[model samples]
Target: MTEQTSLWQDETQSADFAELCSALYEREIAQLANADIQSPQVIQGRLKSLPYYIKRTAHLMLQTQTPLDLDVQNASWSAKQAAHMPLSGQEIAEVNKWYLAQTLTHGLVVPVATTTHIVLDSIDRIDQQNHRFRTNVHGWFYLNDTEQKDKKVNANYRLLKPNKRVMTAACTGHCWVNDHKTNPVIPSLRELLLSCAINWRNFKQPVIF
Candidate 1:
């Protein structure tokens, strides 16, 4: 395992994982506010806020995991504590989507799109003015065991696979995936929508209810 890999990783189940995601995300809101995050800032502010979000989420997800040995690393640190369980991949993805939603809030549905899905569970808005996409779409959700799988060029950046080995974004998703943030926070409704923006737009949309 890479140094980045958690020794005490989260293997928690779906419900617990969901709760943990919510809690950590709530904590993240405070951290961002304390950092004075307002809109229109560069991506750096978002990036800077990440570790706290990821680490906190990670801690919740992997309850068996203790925090870093800050003294050994010479990092001024928070006190050590433990939770009842470990986080799981679902939780990680949940929180990850939360962060992603926050990042991708308002986008003009680009034209030349391949699929027609328009909304996921938490869609915020469809910028009617800017969307040049050819097809009209409704929304879509995971119908069953819920999976996505495909392959793509590093260039376009749309993830083609839902359950690929790395499951996060391609290219390590430095901006997107922070395995470090493995905890109990679920993405805010908006964040969750935004994170799954593509699915919201492509897989979920184009439906008629």
Candidate 2:
């Protein structure tokens, strides 16, 4: 008796998935080519100029409305046994989608621009009478631009300590919090794009800028 082949072992489906990935990659590269990060207008628009190919791909998946049966534990076990018992095509696709979402949401990081400035909200201040005040005034503490190595510099133009209490710069044109306790890091353009893509994918809807 001949053994029946599993859907996961079908070469056609695997080829199709590879083609889909290639097409998406090409589309993303094309969109990125058109975006000039150094342009003042692009920076002013924040991450609006960047293309969200991941979200767009997710939207296409939503159109299929395919119910996914993703068992995390089972998936992990299947991955471990992949060389012996392979997962189905659907399972592979679901795993890839989940991984893509995870990567876009958390794993990716980009370099900060050298010209970017770190503006902090001054919480403590000194009065005109030489008396230091604990007033939680919402003042601005503009730090110098990052050094050649992307290190944060203080008002004295020195490397800032990690535990220093200061308002750190956020994405351009985005509102920042004045929390005096935790140090904030600026979000890169790719980070912003990834966030938007992830949110759109989760909501299964278009995100308006």
TM-score of 2: 0.22
Which segments of model 1 are wrong by more than 4 Å? 1-15, 22-26, 32-173, 176-189, 196-209
Best by TM-score: 1
lDDT of 2 by residue, 29-135 (tens): 56556776677676545445334544444333323322222122111001011111111232323433432333121122111212222222212343323211221
In model 2, how large is the Cα lDDT of residue 205? Answer: 27
Supply every candidate's count of residue pairs whose N, Cα or C atoms clash at under 3 angstroms: 39, 0
TM-scores across all candidates? 0.23, 0.22
Q: How accurate is candidate 1 locally (lDDT)?
A: 0.31
Tens-digit lDDT track for model 1 on 7-95?
A: 33433344455554555556555655676545747546775776565554433333322222212111112222222111234342453
Best candidate, lDDT: 1
Q: Which ten residues in a row have the lowest lDDT in candidate 1?
A: 110-119
